[model samples]
Target: MVFLLFSAATSFAKTPLQPILPLLEAMPSDLHVTVPYLLSFVMADPLKMAMVSIENNLSPPETLQKLSESLTSLLPLLSQLADIIPRDALLWKLKLLKSGAAYANSRLHAVQAEVLFLASGKDNLLPSGEEADRLFKGLKNCRVRYFKENGHTLLLEDGVNLLSVIKGANMYRRGRQRDFVTDYLPPTLSEFKKTFDEDHKLFHLALSPVMMSTLTNGKIVRGLAGVPDQGPVLFVGYHALMGIELSPLYEEFLREKNTIVRGMAHPMLFGSKYETSRQESSRLDTVSMYGGLPVTPINMYRLFERNQYVLLYPGGAREALHRKVCLMSPYLY
Candidate 1:
């Protein structure tokens, strides 16, 4: 008894629903406003049809059910018209029914369900047993039930039955199953120690002997032997040339200490072309191989966004290429 009507001029008229009416009206001359019109003629009552159209287009599951109920109200009228209508008109209605069945079947197949309710008898809308059967067979775990006594107006003729079927399905049930000891146990000290040792083994395997020796020798030479092994620390150093003189030594020290150091280079160095044996290309690939990345204007903002440790040499290539003896003065620029 709850009537939900729409405004005379609504947005649904400009959308997907617009094509439904025109297509139905164009169905052969024999049909007039018969079976196909049952689906299409809702436009005659524009206010009510517009609301149903909108709900069909954008409503959630519950709202869609309510809209379906409204559409169901017209089934008895459609059934009577089908029985009395001319043969050619009846054929056109059948065409609309087949088309509608295909559309509904496509929608049902998209959902994960164990059972499908299908209408197989005549009414205001088309019967969809064949399409429903195909969809049910394709589903991994689902069965279809065809209501021979029902039509598109199932909710109108027998709302209680529909409600009972929906309740029996229990599709709304959703939650965790149970909790057990496996869910909350922490690793024992011995197990934790074994895991840590395995990780350390893998780390050592990844480093070369040369890299390991340099790291061990550098710590002793630089008076940093007392540093604790609690956790890794970021080490930043200033280099005097394009390739740092201490790079080989630092690399070895890092390997021995089981740590990583990333070096940043100017954008210009990566953008420029370099000559090789076969042809000339950018040096970015070579730079990346040496564990260094070119910092360009495009990615400079992203570096700060990720809170990366950045290295900047304001002097760039110009300072490195100059042969003049330069003083280490901050005001030289």
Candidate 2:
């Protein structure tokens, strides 16, 4: 809702999204029909962009007809979606709109919008994965969740649940300030079952991983009773074989200590590098579902501020993936 509006006023101020446009500077996208279909209505009465979405107001029939013709030439797709929406034919117009339109990234760094990039792996239309990485690096408050299995229309996909993503990311808030501790929502019943009983079932049973904590007095013992049950606990672990140590680490802690060990994981896992097509998805999903976030100072600060159990692997993936390593050379990149 726009503030400072006069009810009787016929005009509302509007500006092109030139500031928000260059978010992912080189974010590559095809001339998708959705762009034109979207722009078709808004572009029709460019001056009345805000009014387009007002009560009972709609775009002219000719605008939709123009979009239909453009969609028709795309063939079977045109046949299937012609009655609905098209993507390819009008994609170029989006490119032109992006390039030809007045744009500037000067305010990019200052923009404080909380950005969450949900990139689709099968999205041939645009490589949002690449954009996720760029935005994560450029934006001050940004997070990325790359679904390698999803398509361009991520939220619409059966497997891609938007609500779950926001919940898992701890993006929910009550007011202007976000209390990571208060706003944090633990995994629900389905999420718990999916992460433990289903996704990591094999490892949870077959490996039956174990954890032992050291008491302040120096003696080590099984169960979390030895460790402090309070918050702001830090557990630094050596990288294990293919991150196999993660399941037990997260599971054992939650089961024994009733605490979730938030892993400050390599950005590659949460960013765009970890590909399920090559590596197994179970391990990957575990990292995300069970308090695992991209390694960033902000993430570290948030976990600690929430007084949650923090897990960090100094070796990261390098230690797990490196070969012909010597014990003396502890650090692997």
lDDT of each residue in 197-232, candidate 2, tens digit only:
756788678887766777889888877777778878
RMSD of each: 25.6, 14.8
Error of 1 at 331 (Å): 18
Candidate 1, residue 186: Cα displacement in angstroms equals 32
Off by over 4 Å in 2: 1-162, 165-184, 217-219, 273-282, 323-332
Instruction: State the displacement of the C-alpha of residue 86, model 1, in Å, after optimal TM-score superposition.
Output: 74
Clashing pairs in 1: 31-89, 211-252, 214-253, 215-252, 215-253
TM-score to native of every candidate shown = 0.24, 0.45
**Residue 315 lDDT, candidate 1, scale 0-100:** 59
Instruction: Give the top-scoring candidate (TM-score).
Output: 2
What lDDT is obtained when candidate 1 is compared to the true structure?
A: 0.39
